[model samples]
Target: MSSDKKVRQATATVTELILETFRLNGRLIEAGDELVRPLELTSARWQVLGAMDRSAVPLPVASIARNMGLSRQAVQRLAKELEKGGLVRFAKNPHHERARLVTMTEKGRAAFAAAMAKQAPWAEALAEGLSPDLLSEALAVLRALRVKLEGHDG
Candidate 1:
Protein backbone atom coordinates (compact mmCIF):
# COMPACT_ATOMS: atom_id res chain seq x y z
CA MET A 1 0.00 0.00 0.00
CA SER A 2 1.15 3.53 -0.79
CA SER A 3 2.24 5.54 2.24
CA ASP A 4 -0.32 8.19 1.35
CA LYS A 5 -3.17 5.66 1.56
CA LYS A 6 -1.97 3.83 4.65
CA VAL A 7 -3.07 4.55 8.18
CA ARG A 8 -0.45 5.19 10.82
CA GLN A 9 -0.05 2.21 13.19
CA ALA A 10 -0.83 4.35 16.25
CA THR A 11 -3.91 5.81 14.53
CA ALA A 12 -5.11 2.33 13.65
CA THR A 13 -4.62 1.19 17.22
CA VAL A 14 -6.52 4.20 18.54
CA THR A 15 -9.37 3.48 16.12
CA GLU A 16 -9.59 -0.07 17.41
CA LEU A 17 -9.65 1.22 20.97
CA ILE A 18 -12.46 3.61 20.07
CA LEU A 19 -14.54 0.82 18.58
CA GLU A 20 -13.99 -1.34 21.63
CA THR A 21 -14.94 1.53 23.87
CA PHE A 22 -18.19 1.95 21.97
CA ARG A 23 -19.02 -1.70 22.35
CA LEU A 24 -18.06 -1.65 26.00
CA ASN A 25 -20.27 1.39 26.58
CA GLY A 26 -23.30 -0.39 25.18
CA ARG A 27 -22.70 -3.52 27.20
CA LEU A 28 -22.12 -1.53 30.37
CA ILE A 29 -25.35 0.35 29.86
CA GLU A 30 -27.26 -2.87 29.33
CA ALA A 31 -25.74 -4.37 32.44
CA GLY A 32 -26.46 -1.24 34.43
CA ASP A 33 -30.08 -1.26 33.29
CA GLU A 34 -30.48 -4.82 34.45
CA LEU A 35 -28.76 -4.11 37.74
CA VAL A 36 -30.93 -1.12 38.61
CA ARG A 37 -34.23 -2.31 37.12
CA PRO A 38 -35.72 -3.59 40.34
CA LEU A 39 -35.17 -0.13 41.84
CA GLU A 40 -37.24 1.37 39.00
CA LEU A 41 -34.28 3.09 37.41
CA THR A 42 -32.75 2.79 33.96
CA SER A 43 -29.04 3.09 33.31
CA ALA A 44 -29.38 6.71 32.29
CA ARG A 45 -31.33 7.63 35.39
CA TRP A 46 -28.92 5.79 37.59
CA GLN A 47 -26.09 7.62 35.93
CA VAL A 48 -27.69 10.97 36.61
CA LEU A 49 -28.21 10.00 40.21
CA GLY A 50 -24.61 8.92 40.43
CA ALA A 51 -23.39 12.27 39.18
CA MET A 52 -25.41 14.02 41.84
CA ASP A 53 -24.34 11.55 44.47
CA ARG A 54 -20.69 12.10 43.74
CA SER A 55 -20.89 15.85 43.96
CA ALA A 56 -20.11 17.59 47.26
CA VAL A 57 -22.91 20.05 46.59
CA PRO A 58 -26.06 20.00 44.51
CA LEU A 59 -25.55 20.81 40.85
CA PRO A 60 -27.62 22.21 38.03
CA VAL A 61 -28.54 20.05 35.08
CA ALA A 62 -25.85 21.57 32.91
CA SER A 63 -23.17 20.83 35.48
CA ILE A 64 -24.43 17.29 35.95
CA ALA A 65 -24.42 16.74 32.20
CA ARG A 66 -20.92 18.15 31.89
CA ASN A 67 -19.71 15.96 34.74
CA MET A 68 -21.18 12.88 33.08
CA GLY A 69 -20.09 13.83 29.53
CA LEU A 70 -23.69 14.07 28.44
CA SER A 71 -25.78 16.74 26.76
CA ARG A 72 -27.35 19.36 28.99
CA GLN A 73 -30.76 18.88 27.38
CA ALA A 74 -30.73 15.18 28.15
CA VAL A 75 -29.81 15.79 31.76
CA GLN A 76 -32.49 18.44 32.06
CA ARG A 77 -35.09 15.96 30.87
CA LEU A 78 -33.90 13.31 33.28
CA ALA A 79 -33.91 15.80 36.13
CA LYS A 80 -37.52 16.60 35.42
CA GLU A 81 -38.41 12.95 35.33
CA LEU A 82 -36.58 12.29 38.56
CA GLU A 83 -38.36 15.21 40.16
CA LYS A 84 -41.69 13.78 39.17
CA GLY A 85 -40.71 10.40 40.55
CA GLY A 86 -39.74 11.94 43.89
CA LEU A 87 -36.15 10.87 43.47
CA VAL A 88 -34.82 14.43 43.19
CA ARG A 89 -35.99 17.94 43.77
CA PHE A 90 -35.05 21.28 42.33
CA ALA A 91 -33.83 23.84 44.78
CA LYS A 92 -33.12 27.53 44.29
CA ASN A 93 -29.59 28.04 43.10
CA PRO A 94 -28.00 31.07 44.73
CA HIS A 95 -25.58 31.37 41.85
CA HIS A 96 -28.01 31.21 38.96
CA GLU A 97 -31.64 32.10 39.09
CA ARG A 98 -32.64 30.07 36.05
CA ALA A 99 -30.46 27.07 36.76
CA ARG A 100 -31.95 25.48 39.82
CA LEU A 101 -29.80 22.99 41.69
CA VAL A 102 -30.76 19.32 41.68
CA THR A 103 -30.82 17.70 45.07
CA MET A 104 -31.36 14.03 45.72
CA THR A 105 -34.28 13.28 47.98
CA GLU A 106 -34.21 10.63 50.67
CA LYS A 107 -35.66 8.17 48.21
CA GLY A 108 -32.98 9.02 45.71
CA ARG A 109 -30.25 8.46 48.28
CA ALA A 110 -31.72 5.11 49.25
CA ALA A 111 -32.05 3.99 45.66
CA PHE A 112 -28.50 5.08 44.88
CA ALA A 113 -27.18 3.23 47.94
CA ALA A 114 -29.04 0.12 46.89
CA ALA A 115 -27.67 0.34 43.37
CA MET A 116 -24.16 0.70 44.75
CA ALA A 117 -24.68 -2.28 47.05
CA LYS A 118 -25.54 -4.32 43.97
CA GLN A 119 -22.57 -2.95 42.05
CA ALA A 120 -19.94 -3.80 44.70
CA PRO A 121 -20.18 -7.56 44.34
CA TRP A 122 -20.63 -7.38 40.57
CA ALA A 123 -17.53 -5.22 40.19
CA GLU A 124 -15.55 -7.44 42.52
CA ALA A 125 -16.48 -10.48 40.47
CA LEU A 126 -15.49 -8.74 37.24
CA ALA A 127 -12.17 -7.64 38.74
CA GLU A 128 -11.43 -11.03 40.28
CA GLY A 129 -8.47 -11.75 38.05
CA LEU A 130 -7.49 -8.21 37.10
CA SER A 131 -4.55 -6.50 38.72
CA PRO A 132 -5.20 -3.17 40.47
CA ASP A 133 -2.20 -1.69 38.69
CA LEU A 134 -3.62 -2.72 35.33
CA LEU A 135 -6.95 -1.14 36.22
CA SER A 136 -5.27 2.09 37.30
CA GLU A 137 -3.26 2.25 34.08
CA ALA A 138 -6.39 1.69 32.02
CA LEU A 139 -8.21 4.42 33.92
CA ALA A 140 -5.34 6.85 33.40
CA VAL A 141 -5.30 6.17 29.66
CA LEU A 142 -9.02 6.72 29.33
CA ARG A 143 -8.85 9.96 31.33
CA ALA A 144 -6.04 11.29 29.16
CA LEU A 145 -7.98 10.50 26.03
CA ARG A 146 -11.08 12.17 27.45
CA VAL A 147 -9.12 15.31 28.31
CA LYS A 148 -7.64 15.45 24.83
CA LEU A 149 -11.04 15.03 23.21
CA GLU A 150 -12.63 17.64 25.42
CA GLY A 151 -9.90 20.12 24.51
CA HIS A 152 -10.71 19.63 20.82
CA ASP A 153 -14.47 20.13 21.21
CA GLY A 154 -14.48 23.85 20.62
Candidate 2:
Protein backbone atom coordinates (compact mmCIF):
# COMPACT_ATOMS: atom_id res chain seq x y z
CA MET A 1 0.00 0.00 0.00
CA SER A 2 1.09 3.56 -0.53
CA SER A 3 2.58 5.24 2.56
CA ASP A 4 -0.04 8.01 2.43
CA LYS A 5 -2.85 5.46 2.32
CA LYS A 6 -1.31 3.55 5.21
CA VAL A 7 -1.15 6.75 7.24
CA ARG A 8 -4.81 7.48 6.53
CA GLN A 9 -5.80 3.97 7.58
CA ALA A 10 -3.92 4.30 10.84
CA THR A 11 -5.45 7.68 11.52
CA ALA A 12 -8.93 6.30 10.90
CA THR A 13 -8.34 3.48 13.36
CA VAL A 14 -7.04 5.88 16.00
CA THR A 15 -10.06 8.12 15.52
CA GLU A 16 -12.38 5.18 16.08
CA LEU A 17 -10.48 4.24 19.19
CA ILE A 18 -10.84 7.76 20.53
CA LEU A 19 -14.56 7.79 19.94
CA GLU A 20 -15.01 4.39 21.55
CA THR A 21 -12.97 5.50 24.53
CA PHE A 22 -15.26 8.49 24.99
CA ARG A 23 -18.34 6.29 24.89
CA LEU A 24 -16.84 3.79 27.27
CA ASN A 25 -15.88 6.56 29.68
CA GLY A 26 -19.42 7.91 29.72
CA ARG A 27 -20.91 4.47 30.29
CA LEU A 28 -18.43 3.71 33.07
CA ILE A 29 -19.26 6.94 34.83
CA GLU A 30 -22.96 6.20 34.58
CA ALA A 31 -22.44 2.71 35.98
CA GLY A 32 -20.33 4.11 38.79
CA ASP A 33 -23.00 6.68 39.63
CA GLU A 34 -25.60 3.94 39.85
CA LEU A 35 -23.36 1.76 41.99
CA VAL A 36 -22.70 4.46 44.58
CA ARG A 37 -25.99 6.34 44.49
CA PRO A 38 -27.41 4.45 47.47
CA LEU A 39 -24.38 5.66 49.41
CA GLU A 40 -25.21 9.24 48.34
CA LEU A 41 -22.12 9.60 46.20
CA THR A 42 -21.84 10.44 42.53
CA SER A 43 -19.07 9.02 40.37
CA ALA A 44 -17.18 12.32 40.31
CA ARG A 45 -17.32 12.60 44.10
CA TRP A 46 -16.28 9.00 44.46
CA GLN A 47 -13.35 9.58 42.14
CA VAL A 48 -12.07 12.49 44.21
CA LEU A 49 -12.47 10.57 47.44
CA GLY A 50 -10.72 7.57 45.92
CA ALA A 51 -7.80 9.77 44.90
CA MET A 52 -7.49 11.05 48.46
CA ASP A 53 -7.78 7.54 49.88
CA ARG A 54 -5.06 6.23 47.58
CA SER A 55 -2.62 9.01 48.43
CA ALA A 56 0.03 8.35 51.11
CA VAL A 57 -0.62 11.84 52.44
CA PRO A 58 -3.51 14.20 52.01
CA LEU A 59 -3.15 16.33 48.89
CA PRO A 60 -4.18 19.78 47.80
CA VAL A 61 -6.89 20.09 45.17
CA ALA A 62 -4.29 20.86 42.52
CA SER A 63 -2.37 17.73 43.39
CA ILE A 64 -5.47 15.59 43.27
CA ALA A 65 -6.37 17.06 39.88
CA ARG A 66 -2.91 16.30 38.58
CA ASN A 67 -3.09 12.74 39.84
CA MET A 68 -6.51 12.22 38.33
CA GLY A 69 -5.77 14.00 35.04
CA LEU A 70 -8.58 16.46 35.68
CA SER A 71 -8.63 20.24 35.68
CA ARG A 72 -7.63 21.92 38.95
CA GLN A 73 -10.75 24.10 38.90
CA ALA A 74 -12.95 21.05 38.48
CA VAL A 75 -11.26 19.29 41.40
CA GLN A 76 -11.43 22.40 43.57
CA ARG A 77 -15.16 22.66 42.91
CA LEU A 78 -15.69 19.00 43.75
CA ALA A 79 -13.59 19.35 46.91
CA LYS A 80 -15.74 22.22 48.09
CA GLU A 81 -18.87 20.20 47.49
CA LEU A 82 -17.42 17.20 49.28
CA GLU A 83 -16.51 19.45 52.18
CA LYS A 84 -20.04 20.84 52.32
CA GLY A 85 -21.41 17.29 52.38
CA GLY A 86 -19.18 16.54 55.37
CA LEU A 87 -17.41 13.81 53.47
CA VAL A 88 -14.08 15.64 53.45
CA ARG A 89 -12.39 18.53 55.18
CA PHE A 90 -9.81 21.09 54.18
CA ALA A 91 -6.93 21.40 56.61
CA LYS A 92 -4.05 23.80 56.72
CA ASN A 93 -1.26 22.94 54.30
CA PRO A 94 2.05 23.36 56.15
CA HIS A 95 3.74 23.91 52.80
CA HIS A 96 1.33 26.04 50.79
CA GLU A 97 -0.49 28.76 52.63
CA ARG A 98 -3.59 28.86 50.44
CA ALA A 99 -3.65 25.36 49.06
CA ARG A 100 -5.21 23.39 51.88
CA LEU A 101 -4.81 19.63 52.20
CA VAL A 102 -7.91 17.54 51.62
CA THR A 103 -8.57 14.89 54.22
CA MET A 104 -11.37 12.35 54.23
CA THR A 105 -13.72 12.35 57.19
CA GLU A 106 -14.84 9.18 58.97
CA LYS A 107 -17.97 9.35 56.91
CA GLY A 108 -15.85 9.57 53.81
CA ARG A 109 -13.88 6.50 54.76
CA ALA A 110 -17.03 4.45 55.31
CA ALA A 111 -18.48 5.58 52.01
CA PHE A 112 -15.26 4.77 50.17
CA ALA A 113 -15.11 1.35 51.74
CA ALA A 114 -18.69 0.60 50.83
CA ALA A 115 -18.16 1.77 47.28
CA MET A 116 -15.10 -0.44 46.96
CA ALA A 117 -16.95 -3.40 48.37
CA LYS A 118 -19.57 -2.92 45.72
CA GLN A 119 -16.91 -2.56 43.07
CA ALA A 120 -15.17 -5.85 43.78
CA PRO A 121 -17.94 -8.16 42.63
CA TRP A 122 -18.94 -5.82 39.86
CA ALA A 123 -15.40 -5.77 38.49
CA GLU A 124 -15.07 -9.50 38.83
CA ALA A 125 -18.26 -10.10 36.89
CA LEU A 126 -17.17 -7.61 34.26
CA ALA A 127 -13.90 -9.49 33.83
CA GLU A 128 -15.48 -12.97 33.96
CA GLY A 129 -15.21 -13.97 30.32
CA LEU A 130 -12.23 -11.81 29.40
CA SER A 131 -8.77 -13.27 28.97
CA PRO A 132 -6.28 -11.88 31.46
CA ASP A 133 -3.61 -11.44 28.78
CA LEU A 134 -5.98 -9.53 26.54
CA LEU A 135 -7.03 -7.35 29.44
CA SER A 136 -3.40 -6.53 30.21
CA GLU A 137 -2.74 -5.67 26.58
CA ALA A 138 -5.77 -3.38 26.52
CA LEU A 139 -4.61 -1.66 29.68
CA ALA A 140 -1.13 -1.19 28.26
CA VAL A 141 -2.47 0.26 25.03
CA LEU A 142 -4.68 2.71 26.89
CA ARG A 143 -1.82 3.80 29.12
CA ALA A 144 0.42 4.34 26.11
CA LEU A 145 -2.26 6.40 24.39
CA ARG A 146 -2.72 8.49 27.50
CA VAL A 147 1.00 9.19 27.72
CA LYS A 148 1.08 10.22 24.07
CA LEU A 149 -1.85 12.57 24.53
CA GLU A 150 -0.30 14.08 27.64
CA GLY A 151 2.82 14.94 25.71
CA HIS A 152 0.92 16.48 22.81
CA ASP A 153 0.21 20.20 22.88
CA GLY A 154 -2.83 19.81 20.63
TM-score of each: 0.92, 0.94
* Local distance difference test values of all predictions, in order: 0.94, 0.96
Candidate 2 residue-wise lDDT, 1-154, digit = tens: 9999999999999899899999999999999999999999999999999999999999999999999999999999999999999999999999999999999999999999999999999999999999999999999888889988789635
lDDT of 1 by residue, 63-142 (tens): 99999999999999999999999999999999999999999999999999999999999899989999999999989888
| Over 4 Å off, model 1 | 1-7, 152-154
Report the alpha-carbon TM-score of model 2 versus the true structure.
0.94
Winning model by TM-score: 2
Give candidate 2 misplaced runs (Cα > 4 Å). 152-154
Candidate 2 backbone collisions, by pair: none
